[model samples]
Target: MPPFAYRRSAALLALAALLTACGGGSDDDDDVGPATPPGVRPVAGAEGRWDGRTSTGYDVLLTILDTGETWGLYHTGPIIHGAFHGTSGSSDGQLRGSAAMVDYDKGGQVHSSLYGGSYVPQRQLQAGFVFDVFNGSYVAAYERAVTTAALAGSYTGYAGGWPHPLTLTITPDGGLGLTPASTDCLVRGSIGPRPGGRAVYDMRASFTGPNCPLPHGASVAGIAVLDGPRLTITSVAPSLVDFFAFQGHR
Candidate 1:
């Protein structure tokens, strides 16, 4: 997709306020984490790392925590990247869920959607979702084992698109630091092995400085994936209205 077209979708997301009622837990559920919203449940056999592609041709990487919190990243073009977070529950081999998504390329416009599908534990997942005027399906295969040794390094790349250089450093102990060229924005975060030891890492970060996309002192939650020499991180603000993503190579 062209940059303008992506921005147009972001605008639509910002203007639409659609809600669907489904049988699930509420945001106020005592067990729900601060990062998880309503309509989420901890379903069996749905926690792991999934790699796939959407019907719209976007590459997708998704992580579902044991606690039912979900984080996902999708990209079709350099300027068409975004992230989503929610949870999925299963019943009789069917999966149902919802997520709040943010378009980082368009200044963090937010939207929500509902998804349903089927899955085979440790094998594959297929799901379809609708949000605003957009509808698409995705299929993913499960991946296993992600080690910190593979993630500790220095990476250089762009944030959102080229011409804006960004540097990321991950310490052996999972500490993270990010610096964007010629900018005061310095991001600090942490990454650690998830419960299942799958091809996914738990990630939490905070943005600081006047030049940052998110307000200073804002904390975001998400996940990270390492693909050979490349690293991808996708995170969203607590309000779910803003997101931070990075793609780089060691």
Candidate 2:
């Protein structure tokens, strides 16, 4: 059981279906600290207000690179959990099997492991690989991928204009769980188990940004592969939000 598999959830912006770990089963600060690794730790970035008095803050965290080097990533903190793909290496190093990766957190909550990224020695970093994983469609889908050795989960993405903020979830029974604003019903989907301990998933996506509209519903899709995480959304404007590439480990 490898970690970092949950990255697919975020890139798809699979906000609803997967990654309950972000705000579920545990607290945000539960596993953040130096206990996970020697030098990898958290650094508070900025504290700001969302609307008026709603204080929202972000923290910058860093994990070890494949080289055991402390500063392994080019991106800063407030990283979405399980969103790291690869750091540094060359294509040859990866194909030759020398590409390396490790997982660490402020806390040691993450245990299982996997190779979270591909290598690209040219830039002394890994390749920004992404997958298109789809379980169902619309608001109930699953985007699965790897970010680190210690992190892995699923996610459903929603893009475009949404009527309201949406919530997505995956039931223990492998059923899609959706809480959509347009409908009172909880849209559901299902997937079967696969070999090697990897479960098949359906991606659920919604486009419910505060600024989006109603008629122009968000467009969502799933791309699940052994690659990195990415979003191909044609929203108010066509945009690709590759969270893994933008906000990798520190």
Error of 2 at 173 (Å): 2.7
Shift of residue 235 alpha carbon in model 2, Å: 14
lDDT tens digits, residue span 132-247, model 1: 22222221212344567668888876554324767889988898887443347778889986654345677898878787657778888778777667777877777877677777
Candidate 1 structure, TM-score to reference = 0.70
List per-prediction Cα lDDT, in the order shown. Answer: 0.61, 0.24
**TM agreement with the true structure for every prediction:** 0.70, 0.25
RMSD of each: 9.4, 18.4
Q: How does candidate 2 score on lDDT?
A: 0.24
Give lDDT: candidate 1, residue 194: 62
Name model 1 segments beyond 4 Å from true. 1-44, 77-80, 131-145, 160-163, 180-183
What is candidate 2's CA lDDT for residue 10? 49
Q: How accurate is candidate 1 locally (lDDT)?
A: 0.61
Q: How many steric overlaps are in each model, in order? A: 0, 52
